[model samples]
Target: MWRFLSPQILFGADSTEYLERFEKRRAVIVTDEVIKNLDYVSDVSKHLENSETVTIRAREPCIDDALELAEEMREIEPEVIIALGGGSVIDVAKAGRILMEAEIEPEEITPFTSLEEYGFRGKTSLIAIPTTSGTGSEATWAIVLKNIKERRKVIMAHERAMPEIAIVDPAFVYSMPDHLVISGGFDALSHAVEAFLSSFSNPFSDSLALNSLRLILDNFIMSYGGDRDAREKMHISATMAGIAFSNSQVGVVHALAHAAGALLGIPHGLAVGAFLNPVLEFYAERGVERLGEMNRNLGLNILREIERIEAELRLFEYIPVSEIESHRSEIAERAMEDSCIVTGPFVPEREDLETVIERVVRRCMREES
Candidate 1:
């Protein structure tokens, strides 16, 4: 048996206006300082009759940060939570909302764990409004938090962790920075690619994955060039990729990205960008038939397309490749323990991961030279 899951999505122009439907209901806007400074919070708050805004300090929240937000939520006990920022803010709200309603440890949240068993009854509704066109945190059940003490990312998920709604309005992302545009595009691209290659991929996920991949591949460069039409396509594609991967899975690219982000303080999207091509190349060399199948089905060399995108956007220049090289073995070891590692089309050995990391380093070196 298989299951496909997704939040009810409100997409396109003025989708944020959907929040006004909950007029007079008590609402909390969970966001970050950066987003709060922007008009996004006020824009969202203006729709509700009664609402409070909470800003998370960390760009990437830690366990304690999520727990603290949960404690605050418990105090306010708002009827609805509006996650109004990028993936980090949305993830915190996802984790915080469940932590508020249920009495359980953060690690207890998993695909197999029954949230209902822990007294979670969805007393508080979650609505995610993504400011950026990446991470697809608004649509997925997954939550990623940092374990500061251990220097690893805590990947958590429960069916209930998914938001009740995802508002994908292009208005918010129209003014997004060029760097974010590049990073987020790559992140969405990786999601679609990894979902298609996942061991758990099914027909439902495959359709979304392929569609998202095509859209992202076609529009990423144009999106980065500040084309509103391309940006809108990217925003929609990111959510589709999120739902695709949520129902299926991400593979070695994500596993390695997660490890590097946690240990090296790299942004998740940037890390995903850095590792994507190298890992895909690794899969191709190992004769992962799915890569060839995807290429044939799309009638395009996906790797060649990725290489073009990377070069066009100077994707590798942002990463600290030498630092990553120094910690390559450690990153590989940590990645092997990630939950995403096993869900890849084929499980890789430590040596395979090392080889991929070496590829990333060498590629970056060549780019620099």
Candidate 2:
């Protein structure tokens, strides 16, 4: 048996206003230092009566950062916890919320973890308000944190870790930077593509994945060019892709991205953008029949569209090709150990992963030269 899970989502122009429903309740806004200063925080805080903000100081949070936030949450004991930032901030909140209710190690938050066994009773409601259009952290159960000592990403998931509500307000994303626009677009696109190709994909996830992929392919360029309507569409599509992957899982692109992010300190979305096309090419070459099926169903060549976008946007221009080449074997080995690696349409050998890394490096070099 399979299950699909999602937060109660409030989307579009004034979705943050939904927080007004909890005006009198004790609310704690968990956000990063940078986002806490943004109008989005004020936008959310204005809708609530009793609320306070807790800033996650780290730019790219680690497990210790979540634990620190957890201690603060324990003191506040707020009725509601609103994660008000991008993926990193939301991930910290998810882990912090769990840690607040139960004294458990960060690594204990595996997919099979039983929070109830550890005295977790879900005391505080989590509301994820994503400030960016990517990562879709508001709608997903997954949590990603850096294991600083090991130089690997700690991927965690639990049904209870999912936020109780997801507010996808276009207002929050309107002022997003150009780099973020490119990164988030690619991140969402990769999510949609990988979800459709995941071994765990089902009809429900397939529908969401296909629709999101189409919307992203259609609107991403327009969104980058500052078309408000296109931005709104892309924002919605990112969440759809998140939900799709949350149910169906992602594959090697994510695995590679996660590994690179953990090892090289490359930002997750940029790493994802760099690896996405190359990994897809690897899948196609390996005769992953699902790629052909997905393209046929879309009535367009998804790969070609992705290539066009990459070229138009100069998407891989920031990739550290020399660094990647130097660390190619380590990236492949690390990716092979990722939980996401096994969920692809076909599990690849370590050698296959190396080839994909080589592909990414060559593509980066070609773009540069």
lDDT of 1 at 60: 72
TM-score per model over all chains: 0.98, 0.98
Report the error of model 1 at residue 54, Å. Answer: 0.8
Report clash pairs, candidate 1.
Answer: none
Q: Residue by residue across 252-291, what tens digits does model 2's lDDT show?
A: 9999999888888888888999998888888788889999
Off by over 4 Å in 1: none
On lDDT, the leading prediction is 1
lDDT of 1 by residue, 118-204 (tens): 878889999999988889999999999999999999999988999999999999999999988987888899999999999999999
Q: How does model 1 fare in lDDT?
A: 0.92
